[model samples]
Target: MSTLPTSRPSTPFAVVDRDRLQANIDRVARLAADRGQALRPHAKTHKCPQIAALQLEAGASGLTVATLGEAEVFADAGCTDLLIAYPVWWDADRAGRVAQLAARVRLAVGVDSVEAVQHLASLLGTAPGRPLAAPISPPTLPELVVEVDCGHHRSGCAPQDAGAVARAGVEAGFVVRGVFAFPGHSYTPTGREEVAEQEARDLAVAADSLRGAGILEPWVSGGSTPTVEHEGHGFDEVRPGVYVMGDAQQWELGTCSPADIALTVHATVVSHAGGRLVLDAGSKALGADRAGWATGFGRLLDHPEARIELLSEHHAVAVMSEGTELPPLGTEVRVVPNHACNAVNLTDELWVEVDGRLVESWPVAARGLNA
Candidate 1:
């Protein structure tokens, strides 16, 4: 396994391997292209304009963000097409922002309820307290993508219930672009193929329902890192984020190999006592995102036999397998976070490395924009 930089700024900073990063990006782009599906990668994972630009340059049709704040950041950074893939309730402030963004970029958002659709329509009719310069231009309304529950049952409506929301969007004068779903249940050990099929079937049914309700050419969308490569199956677009930076969960889930992992937290072993090593990075840097099946808080990039058993704000306790030698104190090591999205969000910037050498720094431009 390749190691991280020896002479680094400090411990607990994110280091992205440029070579591996580009390989991951190209692999996904090629897959989506070959499948004849648009790749609008979710930006909530990296939250960096530099990475988004690479994705776009590699043939991404657009971007998928979790929040309007993220949409605004990408818009400012020159992403012309974007989707806020969350069922956002448009309050007064958010309504104004969404409207303003729609006027500039090809923006679409997820919707799951007629009430939210109605609220969106009512908000777009006028400017705050006054009538618009002209009536709400249907062409200018942010496009809507009805959300359908493909067994995740997290936020989307049932697949059968998607038509009502699509109808409400059309009635409200918004161009109902299509349907979307996050098969989050696919993160399990054996759920990827099953949920990918479920996502495809459910989206198809929802699209047919949209057509039944008078919508034509409803765009189908679905994908997560674990399921993105499992064939889109009549999908027009896919939005997978974590494939860009493989995490410990992906590594353990067999979704990605260690060589495919592009990002890790560079930390120094601060102590070695009682046959255990304590590192400077903890939950605050690597993120506390252990799933029930996860072996530990994180993993060692170089030492696959080592497990990060515990994490505090600034310390991580790692235990190596019996017979493995413990590193000396002050030895720098790389820690692969359990969840890359959360890990990236905790830092302000990523140290980009090429061929094991520091190259540049990419700011987490969309960090803390979860609102």
Candidate 2:
């Protein structure tokens, strides 16, 4: 038998099962190691330094962040190697900040357009601090990785255009280290392995293109939780973030198991009527990210068959299929969000627990670094 802590009364809070979190981290790390590739997990999922440290301790090569602000926060947390894996539009103000960061640690940014390359070359070319672009003719600043679109069609040039972008970066005084892609199309249940195969094929082509332009290794980086579905070693690094905290989406997609879910939203049963219970956690607590396939706003972790039919800022209506009884009012239930990324950004802190024992609260240090 297990005993749970009933010391306080704080509902609508995010909870982290420390054991599950560690297991998730170790699973990915071991997978990456077995494949002989580096693991630079996208930190946008957790945005917690303590968790980042856990990843580092688990032998992560570095960290992948979406924003410079996130990079700064992680850098301050002693994460030296950072990759801003987004096609960041370069301007003087942001470049200066990036240069400062470069001076402090190993920094890399994603590039897509030649104009971005030109602007980076202009501002970072042989400038005092760390240059954003560096040429083979002359050593330069931060590394540049071309973002390739692998079936996502969201960003990056075609696989054939990888060389053009790498050439532009190299000519503009940027060290074209490699190419990266996001296989977002793998989010579906049945298409994950195929998408992963397509991603590998695309990266192989992109790497050849870069190598043709004198850019080697091409660090072909890509991986989402779904695409990590089956392992094939093509990309140098895989950036899977959501695995850190499995969500309802991952569970529904069959990408993760319930035991793999590390984070859950604790919501109180505020109202009960008509065989339904309304939870205090709503859009504000869990975030409103309903994919076309999502069953509802979120799913009850304790009651996997139950669905949150409706959600408002402060209410989550729970509806169980078939004949099922709703927990009485004042009962607390845990919800796994449809999307963990957005749900985590909405919370300020996460309650840490190990083996059903309460631990401490971990602040979401980089929660709102949207810029």
Q: TM-score winner among the candidates?
A: 1
Candidate 1 TM-score versus the reference = 0.95
TM-score of each: 0.95, 0.93
Error of 1 at 232 (Å): 2.7
- Candidate 2, residue 331: how far the Cα is off, in Å: 0.3
Worst 10 residues of 2 by lDDT: 131-140
Q: What is candidate 2's lDDT per residue for 1-371, written digit by digit as tens?
A: 12244574488999999999999999999999988888999999999998999999999999999999999999999999999999988777777778788878899999877777767777766432545343323232678988888899898888988899889887766678798888898887677888989888988898999999998667778889888746457877888999999999999999898889999999999888666989999899899999898888899888988999999999999898787877888998899999999999998887888777677778788999987
RMSD of 2: 4.1
Instruction: Pull out the clashing pairs in model 2.
Output: 131-141, 133-173, 133-174, 134-173, 134-174
TM-score of 2: 0.93
Candidate 2 off by > 4 Å: 1-9, 125-140
The C-alpha RMSD of each candidate to the native structure, in angstroms, is: 3.5, 4.1
**130-214, model 1: which lDDT tens digit per residue?**
3553353443778999999899889999888899998888877788999999989989988688889989999999999999888
